[model samples]
Target: MDSITFRSDTVLSDVHMYTPNIRHLMVRLNAVGQPVFVSKFRILRNINVCSKDDIGDLGNEENRELVGVNNASTSRVDCSNTMANEKKDEEKKETAATEILLDDDGDLDVPRRPSDFVNSCEKDLWREKVYPTIISKGEEVPFEEYDEDWSICNDIRIEHTMDTTLEDVGKQIWRGAFLLADYILNNTYLFRGSTVLELGAGTGLTSIVMATVAKTIFCTDVGEDLMNMCERNIIVNKHIYGAAGGEIKVRELDWLRDDLCTDTKNPYCWSEEEIAHLYDYTNVLLAADVFYDDDLTDAFFQTMYRILSNLKNRSITYLSVEKRLNFTLRKMDVTCDAYDHFRLCLADLESINDGKTKFIVEAIKLTFPQFLFYERVEQLELWKIIAEPLISNTQQ
Candidate 1:
């Protein structure tokens, strides 16, 4: 599906195309086996393309190309059961919609469009919503083209189209969520019986997988609508991961504020009740693809620092991100600023380098158990953050 559309009026080169109409850039690549030469390439997400009213970018990038590119006969993600249930559900909705238009309120001979659906029950109301698609039903992360027989499988639910408001990002499960979830599944022992808190847990995909192994999971984001969607997915999939003998609870955590201090007196700060109920039990933190821009990067680290500093016992945070570089025709490559800011914040906490009795950030070299289930996007990396490691992090 060469649907990778571009703005008609933007500047174009032999290998690159600029679409100022959207925030993301697009590059036309050579064939799979050809050795193509280009000045540079970057995985820049065009945030404002589909979501006109929304701000901020998303992950996984609707790589519809990869989805349909895989041979249908040998694809790993089995969507048979998923499609059957959906077909039946759609049929029911279509039938009910047809009946609504034939009622005494209007003429019966005309075919009514969906917008013509009036007096619908709450369930049938056409609110701004997204339909679920069967992209990548959870399989073991594939190692090579031929790897098979994955031990664990997760069926994920995601939206086909979503609004781009800051809150709407929670509608779909991004690639970062899949990568982090794969890490948790591979490192299941570390999370056993531990309380895990997920920040920016869009759609609760990562939390859903973590819930399968951890004692408890607090799925948090910014808005009520997003939290409701997250909670709905958790509840809908309870039998699969929820039955892993853990519970998933949703909460609102706006990380943009400067109120991440330990002071309980300030109303803007985290409430004492929230700390006692949720944060107190948390010993591990999880975030994926949360580092997209500069402001978000600073606030995210501040939230992490506030929590690590307030805690009496040492805790560890696992952050997974893909460094997105923006390469332009002028040979100027712009990268996500969050990556640099995170490095600065982590370096300042190094005991030997900065001499601060604070949290330490280290890069863990983990190459085993490659999760080939989800599409491994460009330059994805995993970092480890610990408040106080029992052993010195020589890797740092």
Candidate 2:
């Protein structure tokens, strides 16, 4: 948006009259083409002067008069009088135009008033508020308009949560999620016909993308409100997944809750029984950004373990988590080392299974500038773990 600055005492007619102070007025332009004045002083005293015709150059005949003495004098008078009358006529037309422009559905085009200009500014700010921020390397990266039709991946489906309360904290989907989802989708053989489950599926962008290739997807999140929002986004973009013929089921899966295995209570939970239904047809499980809290990590892994072991055949779980370095440092004094804690926990679990559970952990380093359009944002590496169950001796 643009800002226009002028002196408060400046009269409407004074704009038509040549004044040095008002000659170099600054105007702020908005996205909607409205101009706003941002000076501490109240400029442009009369709103009536802010009409369509009055916005442009003032008619001055002295500059247009010729040089010859006799003709110049007479011409000057005639020109001055003519210009004066013309200015009056223009003013009348401007008044009529202003009236029409102010009408609810008027056809006349006119410059926006100061109030209208301010309203447009507020709207633009609101848009900025809702827009997501991409952060990498501890900095905020800029966002660009995404134009790719990512649903074309034959083996994967993607769903996006364009709106979220995280916007309240200025956190939104970054390019890291997009890149990972795109990579998995393009590698169709890895995900196609697989029964996939996405945790913390905010806006379900990744899940929707995966659903394109997955046979059946259980997109789960923690809250009912978020689940409903996710469902709405899926319905709005149903046409994108038309080619893949994948099914997307959005449900609430609270990580802290149990009893998901039974059909009677907590049916929304993801349990072995639910996994069994898809055992013959399912192959892989996926989750993104599901490791914000260490307390929840245990339950998250336990749930995955149960799901993996319950499958009749082999199944794999791919989890992507952006390590919060800040949280790690803060919690260091209160708990065991962050990285060691996770490793020891996994080791203990492996001991219980007698090494029957195989887990492979890899770190994917992502560049901040590559993932974000803004230079201020930082990038960090995301940790991905691929977990599978060891075959029994008899089966081997």
Candidate 3:
């Protein structure tokens, strides 16, 4: 039976003595049809029980302007779950937060910082540190820079500096870039006497490292501001890059543009002169830490397909990215949306394959000498991509 019933009588019972009980009684009655009671006994004082965690984070000036992350949403209480499950989960989380934030424990779940927001993806805090290293050329800096991390290779010094409060994530250097750089340093034979292009070359570190080995290195990103910064870095390290028999040029490449993969004569497509300059030097492609978001992952591959397309010679790609395993506040569990999206794109390659055009991706074995002082963590991986079946049909 429903908790509500028609009370035709005007006489009130003891159950109606309490204000809380009367409030619920009125609500239940109104749920059916009690407009008469609604007006006569209008709700005046309402009590809503809330927890300390119910209030969401209202971002500050420095917070909202950050790039690659949206404004955080507010947190609210959910009444759907039974109290038992909620209580148990709360206790488990208290333990999880303390043990998960650092690298030691297998648990990667960072604890909530006692914020009002119910769900926040800002669990992975931004941190900066100067890493010391000696490149294959046997170069090392004894003193670490106070603000920037400086890595020297073949007389070229690349300062890896980052401030988390910025909007352009492409401006920051990631671990994957360093991993790729180390690989290039060890295997200079693959890149020597060849032109190389790096996609999403944040901070241009990988390109700078590769320029020491390759013939000519093209460092490309999306924004003029980012490209300007990349150019400055390349200029600062120009001596070493030139010393290695390569010159550097920065370009703005938006991978999502329809013209990138299409032969259309749209303004967004690379100019004929630009394509002529870049097309001839087809040897290897490099990208690092470019697969962090699902929105850009497919476009990234699309750009790869466009470049690797119509190629008569073989082109190899080395993509190194660190897998993020942070716990999602919205998912309430672990999720790998970026990597999952990548796999999904790979699985549906039939559209791209079409027999005539196809890309074959293979996991580059980790047998290469562990190049980093920290070595490659389980999170970072390198993939060797090859343009298969060749481009037999090309109109000269």
Candidate 4:
């Protein structure tokens, strides 16, 4: 059985656009002719009063990883009664999996209004012959042209991948970013005029959103290509925060490294002044959906400790993570080890009493108002860590 399919002609590009109204960016094909388009995350004006009649339930399967864009298709394999029939079905499974076979009778409904948000439930519905169309780019785009209204003041335009590998997941938008963005937008007083540092700020979406309210934002992540793309996003979305005089400095920060990159020859290296400002002035830290691998989770906490312990003022770190469940052959059941490890790291940090600094962990309730338009999942969580230095007798 062919379980995995690979596309060999994928090419990444940096050609992105931003218009005056901040809508209708041109979708450009990469070197391999794959379409790359802009994903606009609209802000919900009144989520409480929004009509639930049209909005369907977004369960765990629908909101897997709670990422902003879900590209995977779901297919169900039916077992035949006879061995000959089973063999024939197996032969055609590959082709059937790739295409949306809505019904056994081959009947499809009239295409409805386009969906800006893509989820897994729609894919499952297609397999069950209950849905009309998938709203994502490629193969099934409803319109010939890309004209849609995004004149809303709070909509966030992000450059993302129509197709991506597991390694390139950071280049896409995640729902954790939306959760944090909601918290930031709803509780503006917590970050108003504050110097904020966002670790693992992939695509700089959260940082860009934060810049609209915060005084200064340090959007830090590794990889030259990824950082360049993030800087481009910061440039594209500058109009949202530029009028308010909010500044976002895209810098390179590797979680595995103990020291900030200070080499003057490097393009994304940090300056002495910026480093000082980070340790002295930054009062808040933010991270969204960066905890997946065990090794990286360990490195992230270590880096957080180093930054929080040396801060000049009492600082708080807000972390957002979607508890991802997967079936492991070893366990033979669904598990969420990465999220468990993250909770373990939080416990260790809170238990640390080295006499120099203190760490306190708290789980923020998700009762905050929704600002961005996305399928909010229960697995999506927000955690807060408050770090304060302990004053000794000599200091007192």
Candidate 5:
């Protein structure tokens, strides 16, 4: 046999040495007559080494007489023991390396399993840092804010800032949008291969989620800055949607601007072609936290009516609002009577069609503590409305 010393330092130190229950050894042999480069051998077992020495006679007189010679012998024994331990360690390291190599090469027939403790630790880490930091934040902050920390299935993205201003109020994503998106994802099959339009899409969280599920999503907010931010968020998560074969566009859509829906002179305005395209592809309309201001209620409903009327196919409109008592009271206190204005608009629409269009509203109560209460305390109402071509044939 040709002899070769496999250096213990090169292979043994890099392998896992503390793994219990099994031991592995690798041997490489070279034959003078063999035509091949090398031959490899592997051995695996469950074995341990132990010392067998008697120590009960340490206090005997005969032992005392032999103590001097015993002491010298003790030193030699200690040296030998140390050498033996070093040799064993080297051997173990080599064995570990061999096991790893064999496993990598698919030559090791042992089934490797992950330790349960490691998996549990990973789960605990995700629950502790990922859930509270990313998933639990309310709707006012768009879902895009958590893009970097979490993976979104669609192309939708969000950008957020700490800046709070009246003009930028429409930029904030409400928690209700998250709930709406979750509901749609879990219960409805309305998103696939569809073009979706999200009105008053604050941080565009719902749009982001919808973008993941829809063929295309158009996320709109009222302000220029908010629209820019929405676009920025979309760019940030562009890759995510690309991978999923979906797309998202963030644009400014002012419900108060009548020109937005009709002006042909302005490029940013909703042109006739765009309107036709919207009517053709859009099957679902989503809105969240849009009913807070009583002043915009009429214009909001009119816009919704026009959009719904144009769709050739039946469209499902999901509108969520936090029913604020303060707003109702404020409108009542004011001479304008905002609720009355809204009711009058609804009544007018109802009178024209004899309630041909269908509206279903359900109130959802949200839980929050008083001290941490930043969002207005209000009951959320989700409305599912079906638009009818003619008001006369609509069901009440």
Candidate 6:
């Protein structure tokens, strides 16, 4: 055979790195030679309360009041007027808070400490620090007024790719992951102490976020390169969710394959014990933005059915997808073919009359609070699937 040489760095040229904030983290390469960069997502505890001015002082009493402190002793008429003013001011403050929470370029503003929330007297002390002068003296000036002991809470760091081809898109982050992560953060009680399985986890961002509340997480995907990257993300973000006693295991799960990988040579293969635990203890399933391809969508449902049928208990799945409109040559107009096909598959799944399993599908309302920062486009949607095995199927 003729000599055939492959360049390892060629993939690096096609790879792009992304980080939401300005701070830089260490970068490393995956098994496939793609450069992986860490992206930090600052989690918001309360969307309605957080503002640019009250960032790190989430529960601080001194800066907690929405309305200004008013006279304690007042007449009934004055009290009524004050109530109206407070209501109006509260609305305006909430709006402003939402607006200034993120900067123009969508970067989270630098976190501020409780001490940084200063009064008029302390403003002059840090005036020069906030606005540095280009024409400074030879000696370096120290910033004593501003608190340097600031720390961010619930910060989730994910290893992901910035730009790549559609085939390697799973290495990049998507809005669906953010939406799912937000839902988990908003309603942690539902997933608390639950054994969760995340399908097509990609960079494993949503899985990491779920680990904060879920007791156990099986973050599954295909390919060695992607699996390695996902495992690395779980390691970097362990500090955020590990304290809660949550555990995450990364494994290779190919939707195209009929059986789980059991080969000992495969590093990402599942153990016999893990496979048993998955079918016995898993109570929840999750998938984010994995419905773009028709063939993959079909395989995903097959895998879903196989896993759900094998589960010992009824399990619920939360799937998030972003509808992308494209001008197709066949349609010759704006259409979401991939999304339409996904809906068809879902309908087929629900319409199944198989004596073994029952699938119920429902559209989840998007009214839930958003805890993660992202452009939750109108096309983004969340669907809930409840898979219950019949008595006969369970007995088998």
Candidate 5 off by > 4 Å: 1-157, 261-273, 327-378, 390-396
Per-residue lDDT of candidate 3, residues 1-396 (tens digit): 222232334222111121111111111111112211100110001101211122112122231121101011111112234433544454344333323222343222222232312232222121111121212231221222212222232233333222222335665456677678768866878888877878999778789878877877767777655565567567766655666678776766778775432234332235566566677765788998888677798898877777777555677889897777769999999888887777676666535655656677778776554222222557778888776644463642
* Candidate 5 local lDDT, 91-157, one digit each (tens): 4433332233223333322212222323433443322110111222222333343323333322232
Report the C-alpha displacement of residue 290, candidate 5, in angstroms: 0.8
Ranking by TM-score: 6, 4, 3, 1, 5, 2
Give lDDT tens digits, candidate 6, residues 268-322.
9999999999998999999999998999999999999889888998889999998
Q: Which stretches of candidate 6 lie over 4 Å from their true place?
A: 1-26, 46-152, 392-394
What is the lDDT for 304 in model 5? 76
| Model number with the top TM-score | 6
Sort by lDDT, top down from the best = 6, 4, 3, 1, 5, 2
Q: Indicate whether candidate 2 or candidate 6 has the larger TM-score.
A: 6
TM-score per prediction, in order, is: 0.55, 0.49, 0.56, 0.69, 0.50, 0.71
Write candidate 2's Cα lDDT for 133-238 as tens digits. Answer: 2222222111122222422322122122222233211012433344456445445678888887776676566676776677788887765444544665566456
What is the C-alpha RMSD, rounded to one decimal, of candidate 4? 12.9
Q: What is candidate 4's TM-score against the reference?
A: 0.69
For model 5, the local distance difference test gives: 0.45
Candidate 2 segments whose C-alpha is farther than 4 A from its true place: 1-176, 261-275, 327-352, 364-379, 382-386, 391-396
lDDT (Cα atoms) of all candidates against the true structure: 0.50, 0.43, 0.51, 0.65, 0.45, 0.68
Q: For model 3, which pairs clash?
A: 55-116, 67-167, 75-118
Poorly placed runs, candidate 4 (over 4 Å)? 1-26, 29-35, 45-152, 392-396
TM-score of the candidate numbered 3?
0.56
- As a whole number from 0 to 100, the lDDT of residue 190 in candidate 4 is 92
* Model 5 TM-score (2 dp): 0.50
- The TM-score of predicted model 6 comes to 0.71
